[model samples]
Target: MRYCSIPCRVVGALLFGSVAANAFAQVGQQSVPLSADDNAEVEHVWRFAQETESRSSLPRAVDANWIENARLGTLKLSGCAAALVSADGLAVTSATCLRSLENWIRPDDSVFVAGTLLEERKLPGLTARQLVEIREFARIEEASEDLETGFEAELIAADDSSTFWEYVWRTYGDVRLVVIPPADVTDFGNEEGVYPRYAIDFALFRVYDGQALPLETESYFAWNDRSPYVRERLFATAFDANTPFTVITLSDTFSYNGTISPPHTTLYGMLDQYYSHGATGAWELTEDWLSGIKENDLATALNFSVVGECAQTGAGLINVDMEILGIAFDNANTEEGTRCVVMSTSGILALLRTVLKAQGVADELAEQALP
Candidate 1:
């Protein structure tokens, strides 16, 4: 049940929020508009959608409307990004991203598993922000808008210049913890820099409105129970952890390698070297074709690529149609670069169904049409 292919590096939990982008931006230069060839590396969701719309006919790829929907469903957490999976405000994220919840649990209880809505615990001061609007301007002064009720503005400069982006976010502070597996299950092996992992590595929470009821959300990513095939086209939408502002969702495309069965259905892919050094982050999109996947059905080999190492926990792996394939929870070091290990949605749905059924709420989760 061990990963035959060993990882050189393993990423720890990363949190990104509220930091000003001025430190990461070019303080004295006018930011330039995204060029036509800006598709390779990470690009802002708005700019990426603009490019997608301009394409005459790109089959099986996301369009501007798809990007808008994804932006609305994504929530920026203090530790990582989470996707709204159900219309009733249920969100799925990496268990590692929620280690802070352990502090709230009783000291004697090793893990916190809320069996029902009544068992869910409120996390004080924890908030999740959803992007409501994105506005771009060449200069900061050109950006002026009266924020709607319950919305807040976050001004951020582009990568290297004064060009400012005003990101309006709707903050939801009444987030309640729903479920989290034990640490041993979420982080199997306890082996750093190892892969072909069998870890389920996930947690769930529900966002509540001021009335303390589940927030009704029109925008969300439906669960895709099928596992992704190798060479399948996929993309990720998440905020860059190194950036000062966490509201801007960056989009990047990559292909998935076949799953390694036996120990677990682990999805791996070839990701470029995207690592952050302290406060600065690297965004270059370069793939190493030389890195090949090692297959083993009896055991398993775990090695995959993801958008970014830090602050990417809980980011969703989406297809062109905007369906959720899996979630990025852990990263690994390979000869190629820093790659990620993704827990397939099929497996996640199975685990969640088991938990909900035990809690006598399987029917509630099944209503979402998740298999």
Candidate 2:
């Protein structure tokens, strides 16, 4: 299926126009704080909760850091910014982030790099590089009425008045933007088998010429791709609404499971619901208890859906570690409410690691640092 409704520009203009007047009126207002009981609930589902008890937490922290570093040169594409995963420049971001980059590049062009933080500077001194394009492990495609889609994108161009030097000195960085490829697909035959069902929906690119590099900072997370198990405590550090660069230990591992599905679709998986304080472009995964449905091997796959008033065509769903889980591509509004559906993360990872390993760059790119 193809999208034939209003163009995104028109929709954005209408949405922004409707909300622009109220932007500052409610700006900086924090969401209602979770009560101690609520906080306990959050802890029950988040990955960070178990870190204090788990010795494996160190490697997971490294993995998080590696994911953040890789995002350096990449544009947040969606409202959610990219994070580094590797010290050498591998980035782990939502698959939806690639949509904007794909829109910006020419279809015939096989290679493109997006410049982040550097877009506003007039300086010819900073150079941009086009690194190899990494194949995405998943894509957002049009789904049938019975099927739902979950994906979203945000484009962040530098404000013209901004300067690279000023950004580097005052904000702990310079930024650049680059273009990458688009990865979207839909359609799986029963014959493909359920145990290894996969989707290719994320793209990889690089950024360079930044000051106060991520490696220089004391803040960062570790990588742990070798062993992924459920109930393993983990942490997530994201830019607070007030301070874009200030890292805070937001949440912990609530619960998790790691068995591959044998066949058939799984249902009722829970994801963590971390509070988002009007974070212009952020998405949350449901609680972990809900995600536990995948523990059984007979379920070869699963799907995600968002319950809200907004349309689902472009919403994004991600893991607590900020890995791209799926994209919102379809929705259904009922007296119960609108439920936006997304493809599952297991599908994407299966395809991504396979392709990355084929090129002999999966591990390196997954652990590379931002240049």
Candidate 3:
């Protein structure tokens, strides 16, 4: 979640915007197409997109505060989608990102989180906690209170069993990790039809804000308590290429929900959406809409990454953030594409426990996995 540095498409554009209303009506909700239907659901869809797109796309407008909060979920990837889990700066993204950087992030060559062929540095002390800043070939003195001190990180945890992940870890050294998680898949296949069915593709990071402290904000996603079931209503944030807000169904039409279920995984995302680079990380959020979460003590998390063709993977997945690795499904009914996949929420939590244990950060993780 690496392409040769195109690591992968961060977020697959969920089937919202454009003709999404029509689709939603067919399966989950009623239609709100611009041509007709003046109702709450339709208006919510229109307004969410209009207001969200207004934040960055349109500078001078009724920019909503919620948009700023939504930004908490958006993390900068080498073009992939990533999510901020802790206000103190812990984030997560698909481990599949490494598959794209198998060539660049190696010990023998210069290492970098290459976003767009940007300037890079070589840090020998770059461990899992963070990236070290080397100046003039010397590790710079870290300020005692500098929260932004670390840039590089170590593989906190990953499916250690996956050969692709282990090989990349040995080579490029896990570029975006502040820590690692064990994994079973790494670049097994990034193609829309060749998604990695066996890979546990999630990874975590501890980020430092510009002020050198944890991000100074009150907006961060809280992990949901249980796994999402099939056909749940999903709401997500989108990248520049899509409408700011996307509303879709969990997609129970296919056999995806049962694909990677287990102690290794559960709860995958399935949807009919568009796949593109700008859409990556678009859905790396909790919930921006009240409609998605019902009034209950344990409301299902509407936040998650949709799987699609990652430019990084050269491919497809409808990732639900850390929940499921995501897989893309295509059929003749392709309005754009047939389906998108995601990881299971419970699966991510299960693996995260292993990640924390391996990183020796188990004691602090209860706080870390929270917003």
Candidate 4:
């Protein structure tokens, strides 16, 4: 992953114009909220706000309600993305993307882990922007002027139409590193884009407001400690220069069990070769867990179809219930196309528990659930 000199949100607004315009024609001015019938099956916290514009531009395969929820918790980084995983500024993203903080990483320091909060190092001049409000208008000038300080606004229009969407963002400047696994775990096998992969591939960080305190926001995703299973429907949220904001559908979740065959074309094609190809494999991994806690293979990776487009690195993979399953760290290629690869939050949870046990921090992960 590469760090960007310019804020990616601004880039997203510039790139979203064409797509947003095209979406305006496909759906009504307003979007339908999540159906009550579906909510009866499973209570969902991801509800569409009245201020959110029609999300026709997002993939139709995913529920727009969940997509809106995902967007609200998303933070645009220099060249990657992160998901707000707790109410108190804790976020999860790909460990690889944190290379942007190389300057702060001392030569003698262990790049592989950050055992405690006292060890969390701040990256000065770095900032993250969260999409706090979305307002649509008949004309750019019609947008409200209630902009607050420290927040930035961007206007996006489709073609020459009077319709426009004003994106309001709250920027956080004091970001610090939290818990991170060793590179050996995050980049396990160093296989980069290969399938049948195993890697932790995730990292944690905290965002602080101007008061130099942990940011407290209600729009955050709770961590899902359980593993994703086969045939499960999931969504990946990320941003890139190509598509500033994206919510890609990931279905047919499976674990790679058989040997890699030749002529692997697309992720779908690779899976089509065998029956019952989905499974989950886990093992015990221990390095230095604070006071040395032992645990089974907490690191888990799930493979899924990259519907429509490949997800950008550091994208958060969220389930239907709006809980975050993991982070998309890499995209593997088959003969046909590319597929998104995700690492479950189990590994991060394991590390957090270890830190809490040894360091005795009660606020670890903002009191979020863990196993």
lDDT of 3 by residue, 144-229 (tens): 22222334322211123121210011112222344333221222123334222323355555544444344443444444445444
The per-model lDDT (C-alpha) reads: 0.54, 0.28, 0.31, 0.54
Q: Which ten residues in a row have the lowest lDDT in candidate 1?
A: 1-10
Q: For each candidate, what TM-score against the reference? A: 0.67, 0.34, 0.44, 0.67
Report residue 40 deviation for candidate 1 (angstroms).
Answer: 2.8
lDDT of 4: 0.54
TM-score, model 4 to reference: 0.67
Q: After superposition, how far is residue 10 of candidate 2 from its true place, in Å?
A: 33
Task: Give every collision pair in model 1.
Answer: 196-302, 269-304, 269-305, 304-340
lDDT of model 2 at residue 308?
28
Model 4: how far is 192 from its true place, Å?
1.5
Q: What tens-digit string does per-residue lDDT give for candidate 1 at 131-161?
A: 8787878887877667666679877675554
lDDT of 2 by residue, 304-332 (tens): 33332212222333233333333443343
Say which prediction, candidate 2 or candidate 3, comes out ahead on TM-score.
Answer: 3
* lDDT value for model 2: 0.28
